[model samples]
Target chain A: MSIRYPNGKKFEKKRIFSGQKNVNNKDDRFSNRGMSLEEDINETNDYYRAHQIAVIHKKPTPLQIVKVNYPKRSAAVVTEAYFKKPSTTDYNGVFQGKYIDFEAKETRNKTSFPLKNFHEHQIQHMKEVMQHNGIAFALLKFSLLDEVYLLEAHELMSFYDKQDTNRKSIPKKEIEERGHLIPFGYHPRIDYLKIIDKMIDRC
Target chain B: MSIRYPNGKKFEKKRIFSGQKNVNNKDDRFSNRGMSLEEDINETNDYYRAHQIAVIHKKPTPLQIVKVNYPKRSAAVVTEAYFKKPSTTDYNGVFQGKYIDFEAKETRNKTSFPLKNFHEHQIQHMKEVMQHNGIAFALLKFSLLDEVYLLEAHELMSFYDKQDTNRKSIPKKEIEERGHLIPFGYHPRIDYLKIIDKMIDRC
Candidate 1:
């Protein structure tokens, strides 16, 4: 019933998010366009895990907890904490003997995907993954268009290196030409692994 | 200067761990045996990551946070949370173009390692990794003996299955004969990767 936080604090139970009213329609929950890129990817990963097809997971958001309060007969409360930047990509796991790693991002822009969404450390992490021969890519979800693209890290890095002189965003045309459009469906939602299988075949 | 926790609460700065006296000698910090097995592995992982040897990481402990308190002008603090059992093994990464997954545990028992130390999900996760042709193993640290052993998951599973009728522990003698003894040193403390290299060569 109780849990310990990383800083050894007892996390007590409290009700938050009471402002949002409940949606009675179950179908609306599945088709909600308001879902974040992380939520969509999590759903896809859950499907993959349930079917024994792949084992992919989003790394937990790193936190630096500073203060904890232990009360008698109650769960410990984390009185203070801060989020920390993660060193690795958001998602990583194994599929068919190969290591798969990727970051999922959502963009509101209809024409281009901004490169500023990624940090230097994340790009460096992707480069290291490629150096070790693991499959590395990014899941760019265009919220306005409802389209998802699986772009290889090498392609992203190539454009990133040119950002100093060229445009700071990847043009949609360029992404369409270089990246594989991940087919979205009901079960196993994103089906990015299918594209990965093809990529492995080509390699 | 500040960061947010998952819950919406102001995480004000506070001082904890005030009881521990500071050590003046910095060199003694690295040689401290008070380091937990998790800490040692984390240090080893840091060294590996810095040198670009391997990208192994210890997944953060999973927590299911249910409540938060958000105060104006401060980071959110998680008021209530529950610890969730992880669905997969602790450590996993790519090394030498191969997917590597393993769990690390330290035991005080001198003669045998209790099978109860492993969860059913962890064993199942390792089996799935092996089924996909990935290298899966367990790093068992005999704390009393100051020794570590890298035992393959297949071997561990065989012993685990016999727990119903046989003794619910892996005898140290059997482990000594079957598991590879991991060499320990200063720079890259527990060199379990060396054992992994040997395993890869045989494959």
Candidate 2:
């Protein structure tokens, strides 16, 4: 059983914990105690749901089960399973009657965000989302610098599609220029929808 | 590990195979070579994607992985896992810039559709979807009668919320009166989108 992602990264069930990022704090709406990027986004989504802001969720990791034990008088147990490559991005939902789709990734590299973090199908799926007039983007976090940016699908594609000439990764400088810096806050740790609101208003 | 889902149903990996549903037939669009409701919807989704008509997909089953092994010079293998209850419906995507969400269920009952097949979270999720102006529905298949209907989320909730006053299951006559009959055809075996088109037109 191959529990490797298409990007060749080992699949570990998300196991991050932040002792400081108190999710139950309703009093503090703009304080960021710090958390992993995925944790921040998940917290933000829960906030969104609680406040009826929008409906977004992270899709579960795809898996291929090869064997199972259906013992009598008890619950079934998965004996052997393998991770499978996902055909679409991680997060999707609706806000203001528009369909939103995006993928989130983080890197410790200080200079560039590697294109290899994204798989071929993810990019292709984003393109298809855009073709259908859905809002598509990538939430990139430069963990070493504590910087996060919302880059539209087209901008990422521009770098990816010109791979013959471009570097294997997107330079931090280019991301800073083309992407919108996502601000952190107290309640919804990563306030991404604010950027979306601006994008819609500007358009 | 409890592999029994919240609905108390035994969880097993999808293991259905149909010898007749020719998914690759481009020339013979609309041929209803019989298939399971889930299979028909999946094939329809694939066809819609190939034609650039829509971008719907069934979400992967959620699982609670407990243990994984990382062997040297090879891939990781998930050795122990349990099925986790899902928070949302099975299928969702963007179609004509509209956010569409739905669950497909099949029952052998000829006279009624049981409400137990649905969970509280799914109903709550659909309500949230509708609140945000997204499309929400259920693709119900009465296997014994080969009758399928697209029942909007609100309608399902009406009976669900009035559990004390109403029968546990929705009568077939009530469904026929209230739900939109989903027509099966050659290309996309179940043509629910056509009903959506009519819904938009009438509105």
Candidate 3:
């Protein structure tokens, strides 16, 4: 629901390319085919819904609307609104009869995923979900490496708790040991649910 | 999340009383209390969260932003936006290890509840949730009578399916026969999880 990726260089690059139009070369146009992590996961959810596999949705970004103007013969227009920090994770829904909640984030850093990518409230939200028997996890993407990992909420929170000390991030080796690598596929793109299936089986 | 109750009189009444300033009598101020069904449900969800009962959230109203402007060193302002119809129900969450999804609606009609309170997609959403073994229902309120009922999604869809030819509304008598009454309380206001607990037991 909330896009808190901030103005990293990768975000800037995507924003810059968003306005590029009329480039008609077939292969050249196809070369920019892949989307951001959020878009890919959205499409994955869409695929799941269409195939009757799962029904998940990304919540809309919350906005503190200050003012709205209803123009004559037209729809209401939001004249002044500020983006509000979301109280919960961005995406949540029913999957395999279970409530699944997770936050997705991508970092361009090669060796570590910074704890700064997450807010304290989000970790606490995840903890609540886990406590209530809901599936909670983080979909961490290494943008440059094109790698994704599903870190269980408890593991992520454990690493986050240690951020009070000098350790400010989860190292790639640690993540590799603790998290499940979500293999990329064509139809659903990133098949994270496969990891969840394994998790359920292990449980 | 989407407010589709078009020109509802109860809604109008609430809007008119929203800005009253100089009312000092404690009883008078307290008398003009009680909120919309959505607000009541939101407060109930907050209470649930605080008590570690459940983690439910009403999705935000989706908006299609056509234009945005960023002034120097200020947050981006939406210049033009339109409300988008939501794909799913207003409220969904995990309760007691099960995914629960429902739409809440209130009507003034004492005899019957109109089927048009719901959209085709919303009914379809509920159907999908039920197919996935998720708990799905409608929290229906008869505002003038001050009564509420939890109609299972199956019962609701059965009524909705008949709307194509005749019987565009569900009689309140039938609702009472098929739906569970949700008793209002002082703390959580509408204690929906009680009905859900019964549902789980029956299953």
Local accuracy of candidate 3 as per-residue lDDT tens digits, B75-165: 7777666677778898988898789899987766779997878878889999999988899999988766778899999999888887765
**TM-score sort, best first:** 3, 2, 1
Which tens-of-lDDT digit does each residue in B73-148 have in candidate 1? 9866655554456778888888876788999876667798888788889898888888777889999877657788
TM-score of each: 0.80, 0.84, 0.85
| C-alpha lDDT (0 to 100) for residue B32 of candidate 3 | 20
Cα lDDT of model 2 by residue, A40-77, tens digit? 89999999989998999988877787777868998678
Question: In model 2 chain A, where is the ten-residue run with the lowest total lDDT?
Answer: A13-22
The candidate with the higher TM-score, 1 or 2, is 2
Model 2 spans > 4 angstroms off: A1-34, B1-34
Model 3 interface DockQ: 0.48
lDDT of 2: 0.79
Per-candidate interface DockQ score: 0.31, 0.48, 0.48
Predicted complex 3: CAPRI docking category = acceptable
Give per-residue CA lDDT, model 1, range A89-156, as digits (tens): 87998888899999877665779988877877889889988998999999987766888999999999
True contacts kept of each: 0.44, 0.73, 0.70
Which residue pairs collide in model 3, if any? A1-A90
| Model 1 CA RMSD to the hidden true structure, in angstroms | 10.7
Clashes in candidate 3: how many?
Answer: 1
lDDT of 2 by residue, B1-203 (tens): 65754652222111111112111223222213445677789888998899898899989888788777868998678898877778999899998878899998766567988787787898899999999988999988876567789998889888888776357788888889999998777788788888887886786
